[model samples]
Target: MNDVFITKAFTYLPNEPVSNDEMETYLGYINGAPSKAKAIILRNNKITTRYYALDKEGNPTHTNAQIAANAVKGLFDDKFRKEDMELLSVGTSSPDQIQPSHASMIHGELDMNKSLAINTASGLCNSGMNALNYGFLSVKAGVHKNAVCVGSERMSAWMTADKFNHEAENLALLEERPIIAFKREFLRWMLSDGAGAFLLEGQPREDEVSLKVEFIDFYSYAHEIEACMYAGTEKQEDGSLKSWADYPSDEWLKQSIFALKQDTKILDKYILVKGAESLRTSFDKHNLDPDTVDHVLAHVSSGYFKEGLKEEFANVGLDFPWEKWFYNLSEVGNIGAGSIFIALEQLMNSGRLKKGEKVLLCVPESGRFSYSCALLTVC
Candidate 1:
């Protein structure tokens, strides 16, 4: 088996950065009334600026595939060519079309010089690590000499006012809460539009340090918990979800089936607690010591979770210094699966890393309650 290394990391945040005050200008107000949830959610998230692939008039300026391809394009140069890549893996919670796979669309958007194995991993946040895991194992198994893994979300389109206007208008017809719950609505304020990609190969970069891939680990508590975040579905009274296909096409619009939803009750109850447990379990599984980590990069939805997660991790004796933590959420907002990759891009270029230092990567997904972790060594 060949060892894998991340030779390059790059990100594409579409358009210019939109400030907190400018968000409603792009996403607009649901039901023509300003969201009561937006200000409160923003206060907790601490996201001052974010990128959207949409214009101020709510028209999308870039497709999900286009942004993904753009991130991939940044990874190529004299050393690596489009025609040389053996695999292209893309992960996202949002895809432009439901018929063709996200990877297939991105492949078409890339318009590479030759055909390659294109894979799409789907989910909310964990999809990024899942995509990375696939490429890591493929290279480790010698199935490919190199692979490009991307995590992207073109979520502005889903957060638009028109998408949720039906639910706001038809609230009286539903068994669920008549008013859109904070859980059902806050994602419009939380998600951003962006794409980030990592280039993996059997050999490390010779000119500068590369991230030696050690391991990628993920855990899901779906059996004990129902979905915490979802789209294209509605939660039932029994905590089960009804698929979008089960409902009539018109009913889809009425219930906002395509709009993203979160069960805040479930999120508050399980996300941090399970994340700490998973982190400890994964650390033990890998036989790693927390003190060895020089930097910690994570996919965080809100600034609120940072201290909460620190407290939970402290409970397990994994309290690394707060200075060891680095997050770009305040600058870029949460890009879902792309969050970690964007964070990695900044860290990789920040000149903070020194040779032989270890970095820890973490991502927690509230959708179905999952956690992913990985270790990389600067070499």
Candidate 2:
């Protein structure tokens, strides 16, 4: 079997600076609340800071394709001609349009070969993992020697002046509004714009060291598919794109547990078996142990969600070496599918992964209720 590896990775944050404090104020008004007190609270609780793709007017600038194009260029400081690339994939929660896919525009903007194969995938926050899976499979299949995977989002345009204003008021006025406040708070965590990209290729020889990274195995489960979703259609006059109901938080958590149950084999022997005999059975299936795994690159889907995983992982006897694995979500906000790649870049940049070290990349997403896990080894 062919082994696919990551050759390069890059992230493009907003060129203009927006402090976490300032962003809290900005988002407070976006939902129409705009009070000094509430804004301060949001800044303190929701996020630290987030980036965006914008123009002079500060409007949501650049289409999803533009973000991907600029990000690819950012990944390669040395001049690389378009003809050098063989395949391209753009994974995003926010697509540039309903059709044609963002890959077409990326290929066009980069002036890449017209013959190059292109595809687009949207699986919410898990899209990055899905993209990595595809890139690895393509190289392993001998279809292409090199592949580019990108994740980008532009949520600034997703909210309009009116919607923004209303969200703010709802945050302040509605006394008994648990659901609305929850939705508004969650949306606030969703940052805007920016893009990240990764270059994948076949296994690199020991001689060329800087970018070589290897893929191990992957597992997924969609047991509770209806827990959360931003689906269905809305009237065009709604200003920003159509919005959907946030899944009940309790249900979402339940689904997450269901997913862990379905895919415990990959994690078996590594961590101490926790809970019922069922969990022990799952552990035995994979022959994994928590202690054997050196680092964990987890899905920081939400601050709350990560906390849940920590408790469960500990309960199951898996000690997550948080220090070894980098987490910057508090600094940059949640970038959806971009989260994992951004985290991966941090791991590589920190020099954390040594030769043969084991790293697990895990993501749990709302809506389509998909949970994905990738076992990777350092080259």
Candidate 3:
């Protein structure tokens, strides 16, 4: 098999940085005071600033396709052209629409002639890694000379002004109690908008520097746990799938929004345990030793998971090098599927990695509890 090398990687974050305090303003007030939801999200998520694709009036500034097209365009140069791309693999949690597919929309936006465009709907956080995995395999197998994998999300569009306004009113009606009802609302503050893309090549030139993909592995523990994160659709009493269009107009309006629903109880229960197990499995299968990995690039949703993840690593008989670990969740919140790539881009530019050094990229997705890890070497 041919080696797959990542020749270029780029990330695009729209608009200005929205601080946690600004997010509190977006949540508005409850009972003439700021909503407690803001406090909960700020305390739990540990995100200081995040970018949202919003205009001055707090309206969506860009579509998902636009965000993706911009990221792909950033990766283009005289050597890599849109027409030279043989495959376009896009992974997205919040697609513009279900039908035309995000990849097709991006192709149209780029005005590319002809290429295999595919959209992988692999939950929220894992979608980017899944898209990269596909592109890596395609290039490795010589199926495509050049492929671009992108993960773009416009989560701000899902939390419309109307939803926040309605949620504030609903919070006012409820009696003082625990804030578990605001899980979905909390996620709105945690998620932001961004796109990341990587250009993969089947063959490498001696004069150029690249990140070589050694191995990529994915593991899932969905069967062992209930749904911890989900968006869109719900099951009916008759064992049939009820889509958004199947519901009443009012019901559809209430449930059809693209916001994600999370059960923190399940997240707390399995995120660390399942994540560590999956990482260990990937390491064992690929023969990746922790002592040899020079740096670790991780896409953890919050800083709160850092110690727990370390403990899990210890449980699996691996010593996690905290000094060599890097993450961007505090600066960018969680961009879902785009998180890992964004983290990778930032780490590569930090001047910490040396040539020929091995780096491990860890991605843990809460949606149905999945994990993907990729081993790469700096060239």
Candidate 4:
């Protein structure tokens, strides 16, 4: 079996615009935190700006999957055809439905024949990495010459900014709905609608830049599953607000970190020193050391997480500057499975990847309470 390598990557950022400063003002009114507040707390304890999808009439527009599919098509040159793609897979958090899957929709849009295999996989933030693993294994097994993997979600479609922003309903159930306040705080940096696609080619030549998937070294602690969970959804009686949770952000953060450390430990045996540098630095109390890594890409939960992530990286001696990487959550917001894909696109566009270079891709999922990391090298 030969190695599988990513040949192309692209992203679809929604058309709507929402600024970080505007979100902070909204949060100030909601939490009464401070009149000057401008940062909305996001997944990784960060602040970010997000773009919303809206119709001409300002109704929430849900079209992230379409945007993602379109982005995938844009990656190819004139030489490739839909017929050339042997498989298509979607890794998304916000699915339009449980059956048929978003991949089927993308396949249809691409006009792929019925002979092509299509499927969907959900692993929260790990969706993209998991899909990559699947594609890597499949190509190595000679199942296909090429595979297309996409990570997309329209998280903004899950809630209406109008209803959630208002405080009238929340005043009545303040104590019982404590999570509502947290949700409102986090909503500002929540994932937005976007799609990220990666093209994986098999049977690569020696001259081509490619890296084989030796195997995924996943380490997970059994007790860490309860750290994060998806808050259930229900219809609002007055349609003023919806979506609530049961816990605070601190609890979620602690559990998430614990799981990440536990699971990442599996790599220690394979690359002892490098694994230590990655694990300790990423989990460091301060920042990641600049010298320990060549480049780093992380799931953008918020500005706070980015800062902490950068700090930890610096602490570990990785030489890259915090600003060298693209953190587009402020621009496109969180794109769930698409976040890493978006970062990869930015990295490629910058021409930063070179042969023999190593990059760290980290992802942490909220709903499934999972953390996954992929160590990729340019061949």
Cα lDDT computed for each candidate against the true fold: 0.90, 0.58, 0.78, 0.57
| Full ranking by lDDT | 1, 3, 2, 4
Per-residue accuracy of model 1 over 1-379 as CA lDDT, tens digit each: 9999999999999999999999989998886887777888999989999999989899989999999999999999999988888999889988898869999998998776788997899898989889999999999999999999999999999889888778877885655544666776878889999999999999999867699999998898998999889888889999999999999998998878888999888888998999999999988898888999999987789998999998898898889899999989999999999999999988998888999999999899999999999999998
- In model 1, where do residues sit more than 4 Å from their true spots? 172-179
| Lowest-sum lDDT 10-residue window in model 2 | 255-264
Weakest ten-residue segment in model 3 by summed lDDT: 24-33
Q: Name the best candidate (by TM-score).
A: 1
Candidate 2 at residue 210, lDDT?
36
**Candidate 4: lDDT of 19?**
65
Residue-level lDDT for 12 in candidate 2: 76
In candidate 3 the C-alpha lDDT for residue 279 amounts to: 85
What TM-score does candidate 3 get on C-alpha atoms?
0.90
Choose the strongest candidate by lDDT.
Answer: 1
Question: Cα RMSD to native, each candidate?
Answer: 1.7, 8.3, 3.1, 8.9
The digit string of per-residue lDDT tens for model 4 on 1-379 reads 8777776777777664666555433323433343221232343444345655655344555565677678788767754566688878778766666566777777767765557776677756667667766776777788988888888876655444333433423543454432334433344455566788888786433554454333443333324332233433322344222233443544343222111111222222222233334355444433434354466677755554555555554555544676445565656666778888888777766666677766667666644245566656676
Q: Sort the predicted structures by TM-score, highest score first.
A: 1, 3, 2, 4
